[model samples]
Target chain A: MSKQYLTTHTVDEAHPTEIFSVSPTPSSLFSASGSSALQIHSTTKGGFPLQQTITNAHRLGCHHVCTSRGGVGNVAASVGFGGEIKIWARQGSELLPQHEANGEWELRWEIAPTQTNGGDVWAVALSADESYLACTTSDGRIHVWDLTARERIQSYETGGSGTGGSFAMAVDLSRDGKLTATGHESGAVYVFNNNSGRLAYSLSGLAKSVRAVAFSPGCKRLAAAGDAGVIAIYDMERGEHVSNLSATSSRPAWITSLDWNDTGEYLLSGALDGKVKVWDVARGVCVATHSETEGALWSVRWLPKNERALEPGMGKGEMFCAAGANKSLTFYREATGI
Target chain B: MVRFPGQTVQETRKFEALFCILELAHEALLSGNLITLRNIYYQNMELFVSQAVVNVMIDSLASTLGVGRWDLNIGILLPSINSIEKIDFHSVKWVLVIEKEATFRTLAASQYHQTSKAGHGILITDANRLPLSQGARARLNSGSQRDRPTKRSRTDRGGDPVASITNKPFLQKAENRGVTSLQQSISTEYPEANHLGHEQRLEEELVHGVNENAISHHGAGDPVNSTMTLTQTDRKKVVSILNEICTGEGTVCTAVSMEQKQELQRMLVLNIKAEIQAVDHFGDITKWLDEKLCKW
Candidate 1:
C-alpha cells in the first residue's frame, strides 16, 4: 500500500533533442526522438540502451506517443507535427507498423487535421482495452477513433481558441473508456461523458494556461496545471476544483506534462525548466525533484506495474520512467524498505 | 521535502541566505522604517542573492508602488567579477558583461558613458571602490520607461536643473530609521517617531555635505573606471543581473572549457569584491566565498 522511488540510472545519450515522449512495453521502452524518428530502448533487465531507431517515422519531429496494455490488444499511437497519426505494435525493441491487411508493419493511413481547422495533433491516449484512440489537436479539439472498425467515432470541442502557438496540452481516456479528459491553453479542463456523448464538466482553478491533465485511475478525478505553477485537481462528477497543489516556485515555467501512477496514489510532472517532480497526492507535497539538464522537460510517465512479476502472495511491483529536455530516458525502480 | 539535485555548494548557500533575507526583510519592512529598509536591502545583496532576491524585491516593491514590475524592463552591466560569468538577467531587458576580464581594456575604450546618459544601466563588479554614505539616491523622475513624457520646463537661467518631484515620504522615513538604527543601538524603550526623526536630522546634516560624485573616487589602479556614473536604468539592470545569478540562470550554460572556467573564477572574485566594496555591509563577500566556494 506504500511506494517510494528514486532515479537509479539515466539513459544519457538515447536522444538528440529532449526526449518529449516515453511509452514502456514489457520488454522495451519506446521514445519519440527530438528529431524525426521513433526510438526503442531495451529495458528487459540489467541496464537498458538504445536498441532501435525507426528513421523517418514522421517527416517532422514527433510530439505525442501512447500505448495500450490490454483489452482491444497491445497497440501504440504516435502523432507528429505534420498532422499525421501513426500506430505501431511492439516488436522487441522496434515497433512494427500495424496495417489492416498486408502486415502489422505497414502504415495505417495518416489523417490530416489541417482541413478541419489547420491545427496539428498534440496528444494521443489509448483506452484500457486498446479499442479506442483519443487525440487532441493544436486548436483545442478532441477526436476519437474506434480501432476495431478503424474509423473516426466521435469529436468534441474544447470551447476555447488554442492559438498560443501550443497545441491542446493533454487529453486522457478513462480506464473503462467511459470518460475523456482534455486540458487547454486557456486554463480550462473539460471532461466528456463518452457514454452520454456530451460535455460532462468544465472545471476551473488555474488562471494561466493548462499544459497537462490526467484522469485518476478510478475516473472520478482530474489533475490540470501549466503556467500557473499550481496543479488543480477537480472532481469529475461534481465539476469542482477539489484541491490545489501549490507550486514551490513562482517562475512562469509551465508544467509541460503530467501522469498519474498505476495506483493513482502519486502524480508525476515535467516542467519547462528541465525539472520533474513526483507529487504525493494524499499529502499534497512534492516528494522528489529530478533535474539532470537545463533544457525543458516535455513528458514523464509511470511504467505499468506487473502483478505476476512479484513473489507468490506478494503485491505488484511499482516502477516509473522519465524522459525529457536532455534527450534521454531514465528508469527508476520503487525503493524497497530495507 | 523536494530536493533540488546537484545544487552547487555556492548555490545552496546563496539560496539559504536569500531565503533568510527575504523572510527577514518582509517582516522588517512591515515595522515601517522605509528608507532604512531600502538601504538594508541594497547592502545585503550577494552575487546569487542579487539575482534571486532583487527581482522578487522589485516585484514586491512594484506592487507597493502600484506598478507592474514585469513591465519595467531594465538594463545591467556584469563585468566578469572573479570567476562568475554572466550576471543572471532573468526578467530584464538587456545585460552587458564581459565573461572574461581580458576584455576590460576594450570596454574602457568605447564611448559607453554617453549611451547610458539617462542612467539606464547598473554596473555589477567585484572591485573595491568609494564609501557607501557618499552614494547618490538622485532618481531621474522622467527617465524610466514607465515615466510620463512631459514638455521640458525651462530652468531659472540657461541649463535645465533636474527638479525633484514628489518627496517619497515612505523612503524618507525608512532612511531616517536606518540612520538611527546604525548610529545608536536599539534602546530598551521603544523610540517614538519624533526621537527617530531627531536622530535622522543630526545624521542627515553630516551626510548631506558629502557629494554623490565623491563615491566614484578610486584609490589606485582601478581597471574599470570608477568615475562611470550610472542612471536609475543602470541600477535596475544591476538588479536584473543579480536576479538571474540567484535563480541558477547564470549557471545554465556555464559548462565551458576548464581554462575559461579558471579565468572566470578569478575575475568573479576580483569584480565581485570591487562591486560589494562599493556598497556597505555587503562587503562581507569573504564569508560567502570562503565558507561556500572554498568548501566546494
Candidate 2:
C-alpha cells in the first residue's frame, strides 16, 4: 500500500499577504514574507515556533530566498523587490552580522552588499557548493557573482530590457557549469556555455512565457515548462524537442518550477493551480500525483540525496519539500521501498 | 553433527540448516509473529548471530529466497539553483520540485516509516541547500568584481567530489508552482558563455515543441511575427516623436490625429518587430504582436 503523511506547522502570522520564499535548515525552516521581513520556524510538529526574526529585512517585500548548496548549516541568500540580493550565514541559527567574516562560519555566512541600486532582481540561483551566486534582473540580464571574491564575473543578457520586457525570469546552471539555461518572458529559452562563454542555443517552443527550465543531472537533456502546461523535453546535444509531457488533468496553467531527479528518469513540475505532477521521462508517463494543499506553491524542491554509506536503519534519498501560501513547509518521503 | 528436522549425519547439513532457519525467520517476519523464532533464538543463543550480522544474513537469505531485486525509481520535484551551481551533466537523470519543507523532511525520514519489505535507498535534502559543482563555482567566483570577471578552469569545479554528487537530480512535487520571475536577457557588462550548438539544441528541444500539433496551432496558423520591416531612420523618428509627446505634463497633446495615430501605429509595429528580432528568448511572439501593436 502507498502511504503519504501530511504534516503542518502553524507559523507566526509573519507574512500578511503571502509567504513568497522558504529555505530549510537542519532543524528549522526559514521563510521570507511580503511584509519585507525574514522569519525562521521549526520543522518539527507543534514546533512552528518562530526561532529568529529579521525585521525590516528589505524596505520592500523580499521576493526570493535560498540557502547554500552546502546545507542549512551554511549561508542563505534572499532577493527583494528593491532589486537587491543579500546573503545570510548562520551563526548557530542566530544570523551572523553581514560584516562579521569569521572563517569557519564564513563559508556558511550570508552576505548582502552594503550598498546596491535595488535593480529589481527577479530570480536568484546558487551553485551546489555555495561558491557562486547568480541573479536575474528586470533588465533582462543574468549576473553571476563569486561569493568568495565579492565581485561580478560574468553577465549574460537575455537581449532585452525593462520590467517584464525581456527579463530572464528563470535560470539554471548545470552541475559542471558547462551550460547555463535561462527561461524568458518572451517564451524563449536560451542555453549558454558557461565554459565556452558564448551563446549556444536559442530554444523556441513555448507559445507562452517559459517559467521554469531545468537541466538533467547528466546535463544531456534540458526540461522546460510554463504557461503551456506541458513539460518540454529537449536533447541538449541536438537542440531539438525530444518530447512533450502532460497528464490527463494537465491544463495550460503556468508552471512555476522544474526539477530533475537524481537519476534523470523523471521530471517534476509545480503549476499555478496548486497541483504537482511527476513525469517519467523514459516511459513518458505520469507516475504520481500529489495534492496536499490548495495554496499557491511558491517553491518545490528535492532534498539533497544522502549518499553517505548506508548504515542499517539509516534513511537516505527520495525526500522532497514543498511550501507556499500557507506559510508552512511540508516534507514527503517515498513510501515504496524503491 | 547437529541433528535437526529433515537432516541426518550424511546430509548436507549446512544448506539444509540454513534454509530451515531462514524459512522460519521469513515466515515469522511475514506474519508479524516473530515470537516463535525470538524464543528459539533466545533459548539457543549460539544458533543465531548478533542483530547486525543477522540483518546481513537475512538480506542474503532474502535475496537467495528467489525474491526479485528491489527496483527503486527515485523521483524528485524541484526548482532553481542553476545560477550558483550548474547541475553536473554526469550525475542525476530525474528531478522533482516541492513547495513545502514538511513534505520533503517526512519523505527523507520515511526510511523508518515505510513498511515495505523491499528496501530502497533514496536521499532527500533541501533544494536550496543541495550540492554545488565546480564550473558553477568558477562562474560564481569570476563575478566578484565588475571589471575583472574571474575565470576558472571548468575541470576544477568537476574535481571536487561533492560536485559529482549534486549533479544528480532529486525528485519531489508540490501543489502551487514556485514563484518564478522573468528571464531577462538585458545586460552588456557580462556576456553569456558559449557552448556551441550543444546549448542551442538543448534549448530548442526543451523550448520549441517540434511536434506537428504543437506547431500547427501557433498564432492561428499564420505565424504572426514572421515578417517585419522598419528602417533605422523611421525607428529613430518614431522614438523621438513618442518621447516628445508621451511626457507626463503635456505628452497627451490633442490626442494626435487618427491618420497620424495610424502612422504612429505602423511605426510602432515596425519598431516592436525590430526589438523582438533583436533579442533571443522563449514563448510565441505572435500573441505578443497584437499587444505590442495595440500599445503602439
Candidate 3:
C-alpha cells in the first residue's frame, strides 16, 4: 500500500532564487538558496516563522547545507558555489558569525589556496559529532578535515591527477563515522574506511553521472542515484551491487538528491523531473510520490521525529521538506488513518 | 559416456545441461517470449553451476546460429546491427535509426506516428560498434528495386484499364502505406510519452480542479458560514488574524497576495465544513490553511 503526505506549510517566496538545500537541526530548519544569505525557521513554533537570516553567508551563492545529526544539534555546515565552506553554531536562538572560534567552541581550518580553485567544493557532510567535515572537490578528491584539530587529516583520491580524475559531485559521512562515500560524475561510487584512511570499495554499476550518495543510518547499505534514473543500492559489508530501485514501466528522471529517514526504513529522493518519492526499502517499491512544481528539485530532507511522535497510535508519522527552482519550502506530513 | 574431444564426465554433463537449456531458450524465442541468460541459469541452477557457464553457452549458441546473441532476441538486448546495411531495410518514406533500445521502445509506444500518418521505418543499431563500410553507405544512399514505382493491374479498378496498367508510381505508393502500418505497429508496442503525459495531466487536473471547485463553492455560499463566502470586511479580519498568529510567533509570514488570501479563506471553510462535529481551534485552522496554500 502507498503512503500519503499533506503539505503542512509553504513559504512560497522563501528565497528570491532557487532553494538548493534544506537542513534540519533539533529546533530549527536552515534553508540555503541561490541568494547569499541562509534563512533559518523555527520548527518548534506554530507557524515555523523565520528566526534569523545570516546575510552574506556565501558571496556568490550557497548550493549545499548540512546539519550535524549527533552532538548538540547546533552545528551546521554550508558550501557555496564560490568554493568556500562555512560552519555555523547556534547560540541561544541566535546564529553567530561564520568560523568565529570562541574558547574551543569552533575549529578553524585553512585549506591550501592552490589546491582548490573556484567551484571546486561541490558538496559537504559533517560527522555525527561535528568533529570531522568531509567535502568533495571537482577533481574527484574527498578531503576529510579534522574539525577539532583544524587541519586536513585525510585525502582520498578516486584516480590519479590529469585525465583520470573524475569530478566528485556528492559526499556523505556515515552516522557511525567509520565510512565516507562519494559519488562522482563518472558514475563511480567510492567508499573509504576512516580507520585505515584508504579506499575500501570502488563500486561499479551505474554508467551515468551520479548526483547523490547517501549511507543508511545503520551504515549497512549505501544508495546512489543520478543521470541513470535508477537508485543503485550496494551492500557495504560485501561491497556488492545488491539491487536497483526503479520504476517498472517508465524510468524516472535524473535524481538530484537523496536522504534516508532516521529509522532507515524509508528513503527520500528528489529528481530533476520535480518529483519527490518516498521509497520503502524493505519492499523495494516507491510508496509515495509528490510533485508540486515542474521545475527541478534540488534537495529533500526528512525532519527528525521528536519524542512525542514515538508514542504508539500516532502511526509513526513521517514528515519531509523539499525545495528547488520553485523558490518555496514545502513540508509534507504523513496522512493518518487513510 | 561418449567422449567428444578432450572432455571428462563432468565436462560432458555440463555440456549436456547447457544444450538442454539452449533448447528451452530456443522454444521460448519461437513462442515470442524473450528469456535472459541469467533467467536460464537461475531456472536450472543445479545443472548450470554458475552464471558464467550459462553466459558461455549463450555465446556458443549465438556463434552456431551465425547471428549475434542480441539478434536471437533472447533477452532485453542492446541493438547490435552496427551498420545501416546490416538492417533489413525496406522502402519507406522516412527512416529512424535509434541508437538506444529504450528510446526506440518509447517512440514505438507513442501515438505520434499514427496521428501524423507518416510512413516511417525504425532501425536499431549499437552505437559502440564500427561505422558503416563504403559499400554499405553507397547502398543506403542509392535507391533499390523496392524504391522503384510499378504498374498496377488493369482489372482491379474496372474504370481505366490502360491508365491503371501504365501507372508507374503504384508500387511506391503501396510501399508507403505498408511503411505507415509498420510504423503504427511499432509505436503501439512501445509508446514513449503516453505514460508520463498521462501522469502530468492527472496531476494538473487534480490541483487546478480542486482549487477551482473550492473557489466556486465559496462564491455561492453565505459569507460567514462558508469560508470562501468572505466579504471584504471578513477577508480583512481573517488576514489580520492570520498575520497576528503567524508574525507574532516568530514565523516569517510574508504579505500574501490577494489571490493567496482568498485561497486560504476557501481552505479554512472547506476544512471547517469537512469536520463539522469537532471544535475548531486557531492552530488547527492555520495549519490546514497552510496545507491548502502549499497544495497549489
Candidate 4:
C-alpha cells in the first residue's frame, strides 16, 4: 500500500548557495551548502526554526555535512570544497538550552590538506557510536578513522587493488557498525565485512553512477540510487540485490540522496529533478513521491523516531527533510489516520 | 592491484575519464546544469586526450544501458561529416608523408597537425581506421545503408547474472532492454583487472556468509572528536612507515581533487594492533604485514 507525506515546514533560502547535504540528529537537522557556514535547525512540530549557524565553519564553502544518526546528537562531520574535513562535537550543559533543541556542536578535529595535510576525502559517514568516521574518496576507496585515536583505523579499497577501483561515490555504515556499504561511480555496490576486514559481498544490478547509498535501521536492507534514477534495494544479510524502486516518472532523474525510516519499512529517495519518493520495501513500489519544487535535490534524510513523539495527534510515523538547488530545507511527515 | 599514476596508461585513462564523467554528471544533476559532450571533451581535453576518445567513452556507457544519450544528458559532438563530395587535389597546398610510426607518435604528441607552420592544413593519420575508409566509402556510394551501430562481438548479450537473481519490476517498462549490456564496457575495459567486471559478480554469488569475527566490537558512545594527532609515546614523537604509505599512496591514486576516496583499513588496523601486541618479536610483524599487503 502506498503511504503519504504532507509538507509540514520549509526554511526557504536557508543558505546563500545550493545546499549539498542535510543530516538530521534526534532533535535537530544540520545543513551544509556552498556557503562557508553550516546551519542547524530545530525539528519541532510546527515551525522548523533555524537553531544555530556555524559561520566560517568551512572557509571555501562546505559541500557535505552529516550528523550521527544513532547517537544522542553530539557528533557531526563536514567536508568542504577545499578538500578539508572537520569533526564537530556538541558542547555546553546537559540540560536542553532554551533557544536550541540541539546543543551547539564545536569543531574538534580538523583534517585540512592545506593545514595539517589531509588526504582527498569526499562523502563522510559516522558510525552508530560516531567513534569511527568512514569516508569515500575520488578513487573508489573507503577509509575508516577512529575519532578518538585520531588515526585512520581501517581503509577498504573497493577498487579491489591497493587503491585502483571506481570512484566510491556514496557510503553508509550499517547501524550495527559491522558492515560498510559503498556505492561506486561504476554503479557497483560493495558491502564490506568490518569485522573480517575483507570484502564481504559485491552486490550487482545497478549499472550507473550511484550518488547515494543507505542502510536501513535494522541493517537488513540497503537502498542505493544515483544517475540511473532507480532505487536498488539489496538483501543486506545475503548480500543479494533483491529489487529496484523506480518512480512513476517516465524519464527518471538521477537520485542524489537516500535515507531509511526508523523501522526500515519505507525507503526515502531524492532525485535530481527535486522529486522525493517514499518506497514501500515489501511491495517494491513508490508509495509516496513529492515534486513540490522544480529544482533538483542533493540530500534527503529522516529525523530520528523520537522527533515524531513531539506532537500527540501526529502519531509516531516518519519525518524526512530534503534540500538541493532550491536552497531550502523542506520537511515532510507521513500522514497518520489517527 | 594498487594502480598508481602511470602504472598502465590505458586503464588509468579509462578510470580518469569515467571519474570525470560521473563528477560532471554529478555536478550537473545537483544544480540542474546542462553540459554537452563537446564541452566536456574540450574542457577536459588535458584529461581525456581527444574528442574521439570522449565520444567512444560516452557511447560505451550510453549504448550499453540502452538509454538515450540525452538520458545521461550527454550530447553528441556533431561528427562534422560535411565531406566535400569531390576535393580539388590540384589546389592542395602541400602533402607531408611520414612513413615511420615512431615519428608519427612524437609529432602527434606535439599536436603537429595544428601547430605546423603550414596554413589550411588537414592531417589524416591511420586513414584505414577512419570512418570514411574504402569499405565505408563503397557502402556510402551505393546508398544502401545509412549510419547504424555496429555489433561488437567481444561484448555479447550474455546471460545477465544480475537478472538471473532478482526480479526487478521497477524498470519493467524497459523490458530488460540492455540488462546484460550495462556490465559490458565499464567493467571489462580494465585489461589488467583479472576479475573486475563480470567474473566478480559470479564469485560474490558463491560467497554468501560474512566474517562474523569482524563483528566483535559493539561500542556505542556519544559521537565525539579530539585534537590528538597520530599516536604519541608521551610527547616523544613517533611515526610509522604505515602512516607514510597510507597518505602518500592515497594522494597518488586519487590525484589532487576535492573528491575524497576512503580506504577502510580494518585489515591494516587488525595487523597493526596485532603487531603492537607482539612488539617483543619485531620481525614477525613485518612478515605479517607484508603478507597482508601482498594479498590486498
Candidate 5:
C-alpha cells in the first residue's frame, strides 16, 4: 500500500520541445517531439544514454512514435504533425528509413486526408509482427494498411461521416493481430474484427472524451480512460462493461494515458493533475498514487521485462517511463528495498 | 425496577429495533454492496412498523458511524434528485441539463455521454419533477463562473518560436541558405576537392564503376538524377542484388561476395536512413503534387 514505484532515472532535457510520445524497442527508446528530430536513447545503459538522433525526421514535427511489441522484429512507425507516416527498420541500434535503390527514401504508402475526404488521420498502431498498420482519422474511420503490400486493405467506419462524425483520438492493435480498438472524441469505444472487418462491439460507459485505449496483455480485456476521470474496463470476450475503476479522491481528474503491466494485474494511469496511479484490477481499487509534478502527462509506457527478472529466485517487478509537458522522461520501478 | 430506573418497555423496544437495523446495514456495507431502506423495512416489518421508522434508524446509524447515509451504502426508494445536491462537481468540466423524464431515460439507457460530443460533461436531469438541490445549484453556478479552459494545450504551442514557423516556403528557403553556407565553409576549410585533377579522377572512377555494372544496376535508375529507363533484365538484376543484401546470402555471380557483405549491409542501412529523411522532407510536397494532378 506504500509507494510501489520509485523514481529510477530522470532525463532532464530529453527533448528541446515537448515530447509527445515515446516508443521502446528491445534495447532502445525512440521519442518523438515538437521538434523535427526523432531521438533514440539506449535503454541498456544506466543513464539511458543518447544513442542517435534522426534529425529532420519530421519537417513539421512528429507527434506519435510507436514500436511493435512482443519481439516484433525491430520495426517502428511514426506519425508527424504534417500528416505523414514514416516506417523505420531497425538495424544494429539504428532506425533507418525504408528506401529503394534510388538513394531516396521510398514513400512506401500514405494515408492522406484531402479537402473532400473530411477526415484527418490522428493516431496509428502497428501489429505485433509489424505486418499490418492501423490508423484512425478525424471522421471516425479506422483504416488497416498491409505493410508488405503497401496498400489499405480494409476500412471500418463508425458512421455519421458528415459534420456529425467525431474525431478518433486513440487506437490500439491487439497482440494477436485479430482485433483493432479505437477511442473517439464522442466518448465511444469501438472494437473491430480484423478478419471480417466488422465492428465487434460498440462499448459504452464513459461519457467524456476517451483519450486512450489499450488491450490487456492476454487480450481478454480492454481499458479506456479520458475526460470521464474513471477507467472503464470491458470484457473483450463478451463485449460487456465489466467494472469501473475510480480513484479515492472525490474530485475527478481527466486521465491522459493508460498502460498495463506484463501480467495485466495492475493498470497504470497518468492524468492532468500529474498524478500517476496504479489500480488493482481484480479488487477494483486504486492501491497507490505518485505525484512528482503538476504538469500534465501525455504518455506512459511499461518497459519490457528483462531476462534477469525472469530467473527463478528473483521476485516479479515492473518499471515504466512517463513524459509530457515537463519535457523530461522519468523512469519508475517497483520499490524492492534495494 | 429490575432492569434500570430510566429503562421503560417502550424505550427498550426502540433501542432493540435501532440495533437490529444498524446490524443489517453494517453487514451490507461490509459486503461492499448497497442496500435500500425499503428492503430493510420489509426484512423486519414486525420490528419496524413503517418505512419512515427504517429511514430514521438509518440516519441514527449514520450519525453513530460518523459518516453520511450514502457512505453507509444505504439508498432510499425512488430517491429524489435533490438528495444528490451535495455530490461534488468541482472537478467536472461541463454539465448537461435535461428536462424530460422520457428523454432522460433514453439517454441513460444508451449512455448518451459516450456518444455525445461534449467531452467529460456531467449529465443532470429533472426526471422526478423535483426542484434543483441547493448543492447542485451551487456547483452549477461555480462551474460556469470558473475561467479554466476545458481543453489543455497538447504540445507547448506558444512556447517555441521555431514550432510556430510552419510555413513551407520559408522553411525551404532557410534550409537552402543553411546548405549554401555549409558548402562555402567546407570549401574554404578543405581545398583538396577544388583541385582539377582530383575532381576529374573521381568522375572517371565513377564512370568506370558504372560501365562495369558494379553500381549502375541500382544507381542508374534514380528518378532524380537519371532519365534512363531500366530494362526488365536490369531490373531483375537489381532486385536480386537487394534480396542478397537483405537476406545475407548469395547463390550466383550476381550475389554480393562474403567479404563485401558487411560493407553492403552498412551501405544499405545508411541509404535507408537518407531515404527516410528525404521522404519526411518531401512528404508535404508530394501531397501537393498529388492534389495538383487530381485537379488537372
Candidate 6:
C-alpha cells in the first residue's frame, strides 16, 4: 500500500533565483542557489523559518551546498559557480556586535579555484568525523583532503590522464568513513576505498550521465540516478549490481538527488520533473510520489526528525524537503493516520 | 581564578550563552513554571540575537546537561491559549488532545471547540504538555547513584558556577511556589536577574535547580512524567546538584573554531533582519494574542 503524505508547508520564493541545491542537518536545512547568499531554514520550527543566512557567500552565486551526513552535523561545505569550495563550521549563534555578522554558520576555510587539486573541485563531501573531505573535478578525478592538515592526502584518477575522462557530477563520503563514492558524466559510478587508497567498485547500470550517488546510512547499499531516469542499488560489500528502481511513468525524468533515510529502510529521490519519490528498500516499491511543481527540482533531502517533543497519537512518521527551479522550498510530512 | 584554560574564543562565547540559558532554566525549574525556547528568546533579544541562537543553545544545553529538553522547562510555545482560567470546561464533554502543533493550532483557531457537541467546551490542552518521548522517559528512570566530589568541595575551590542556585532546598521552593498565583508559577525571573545565578542575591535564590532535575528522574515509574517531564529531583540531589550533573566533561566539541561576537555579526548579516523582525513582531504578537486569544 502506498503511504499517504501531505504537503505540510511551502516557503514561496525562498530565493530570488532558482535554488540549485539543498542539504539538511538534524535541525536545519541549508539551501543555496544563483544568489550571492546562502540561507538556512530551521526544519524543526514552524514554516521552516529562515533561521540563518551567510551573506555574500559566493560573489558569482552558489550552485551546491552539502552538510555532513554523519549525525553530529558539525560541518558543511558549499561550491560556488566560481568553482570555489567554502567550508563552514556550526557554532552556537553567538551574539556579535555588528550590523553584518549574524550567522551561527561561520565560514572556516576556502579552497580557491585552481587547475591543481585534480582540476577545479566540482562536488564535495565531508567524512563522518569531519576530518576528511572528498572533492570531484571536471576531469573525472577525485581528491581526498585531510581537513585538519589542509593537505590533499590521496587522489584517484578516473582515467582522464590529462584529458577526456568524464565530468564528476556528484560525490559522497560513506558515514563509516571507509568509502568515498562519486558519479560522473560518462555514466560511470566509482567507489574508492579510503583506507587502502584503491578503486573499490566501478559499476555499469545507468547508461545515461550519472548525476547523483549516495551511500546508504548503514553503508550496505549505494543508490545512483541520473539521465537514465532509473535508480540503481548496488551492494556496497560485494560490489555487485542489485535491483533497479523504475517508476511506472513512461518518460521518467532525470533524477538529480538521492538520500537514504536514517534507518536505510526508505530512500528519498527528486527528479528534474519536480517530482519527489519515496521508495521502500525491502519491498522495492515507490511508496509515495509527490509532484510539488512543474519546474525542475535540483535537490531533495530528508529532514532529520526532531526526536524531542513528539505529541500523543503522532505515530512514528517522516519529513522531507525539496527545492529547485521554482525558487521555493517545499516540505512534506508523512500522514501518520495512514 | 578566571581560568577558561585552553578554550578557544568561540567556546568562551558558547559557554557564555550556556550560562545565560542555564540561569534562566534554573529559575524556571525552581519557580515551577515551564517556558519554551521562543519564550526565552523574547525575554532577551539582545542576548539571544535571534530565535535560531536560542534554538542552538537549547539543543546544546539539553545534550550538555544530560537532562531532558523539557527538564530545562524549554519547549515550543503555544499561541492558542493565553490563560487556562478563562477556559470554561463546565459545558465541555469531549476533551481532545491532538498531535502536531499545526493541526492543534488549526483546530483551536477554527472554532472547533464551539462546534463540538453543539456549543459545549472541548478543553483543548496545551499540546506542549504532551507525554514525554520514550528516550526522555528512559533517561528519567533514576540511574544508579555514584559517589562524586561534594559541591562544597567544588565551590570552595571556586570552580563550579552553578553551585549557588542548585544548592538550595528544592522542597521549600516548591511549597513557596504552591501559594503563588498561577501567573507567578509560570513566569521566570532568571533572564532578568543576571547573566549568571551567582549575581543574584542570596535572599532571592528561592528555588532549587539540579535536584529538581533529579527528582523528575525518579518520576518515571509514576505517571507524574505524563505532565511533560515535570519532576523535582530528590531534595538531597537538589542540595548536591553537581554530583551527577556534568556528564562527559560537558558538551565537548570535536574541533571547530567559534567566531567572536563582532565577527559573528558581520558573518551573519542576513540573520540581523530576522532579529529585527522578531523585535518588531514581539509587541504586535502580544497585542494580537490579547485581541485574538484572551477574549476567548
Candidate 1 local lDDT, B1-296, one digit each (tens): 11244278766665555455455555545654233222334456554344545546555655665765323322122111232332332232111221112222223233232233322222221121111222221121112211111111101101211111111122223333444332122121223322322211211111111111111222111233222322223322322332222233234222211112221211111111122123222322223222221221
How is the predicted docking of candidate 3 categorized under the CAPRI scheme?
incorrect
Estimate, for each residue in A225-268, the C-alpha lDDT of model 4 and write its tens digit. 87667888889878888888886655577677998887778888
Top-scoring candidate (TM-score): 4
Q: Is the docking of candidate 1 incorrect, acceptable, medium or high quality?
A: incorrect
Order of the predicted models by lDDT, top scorer first: 6, 3, 4, 5, 1, 2
Q: Per-residue lDDT of A71-150 in model 1, one digit per residue for the tens?
A: 22246688764557887753332232232112223345455655335445667888886668888875567889887687
What interface RMSD, in Å and to 1 decimal, does model 4 have? 16.5
TM-score of 1: 0.50
Candidate 4 ranges with C-alpha deviation above 4 Å: A92-102, A114-119, A307-317, B1-296
DockQ agreement of candidate 2 with the native complex: 0.01
Q: Over the stretch A80-153, how does candidate 5's per-residue lDDT look in tens digits?
A: 65556787765532343331111212234445544115455567888887778888775678888888787889
lDDT of 5 by residue, B135-171 (tens): 4333322221100111000011111110111101111
RMSD of each: 23.4, 32.9, 23.9, 24.3, 30.6, 26.3
- How do the residues A63-115 of candidate 2 rate in per-residue lDDT, one tens digit apiece? 57765433333566787544567776655444443332222222233335332
Better of 3 and 6 by lDDT: 6
Which candidate has the top score in lDDT? Answer: 6
DockQ of 3: 0.01
Instruction: Give me the overall lDDT of model 5.
Output: 0.59
* Model 5 chain A: worst 10 consecutive residues (lDDT sum): A97-106
Q: Worst 10-residue stretch by lDDT in candidate 1 chain B? A: B149-158
Instruction: Give the per-residue lDDT of model 3 (tens digit) for A253-295.
Output: 7687899998898999997667899999888999999999876
Estimate every model's Cα lDDT from 0 to 1.
0.51, 0.48, 0.60, 0.59, 0.59, 0.61
Runs of candidate 1 exceeding 4 Å displacement: A1-4, A69-73, A90-106, A114-117, A160-167, A250-252, A307-317, B1-296
lDDT score at residue A221, model 5, on the 0-100 scale:
92
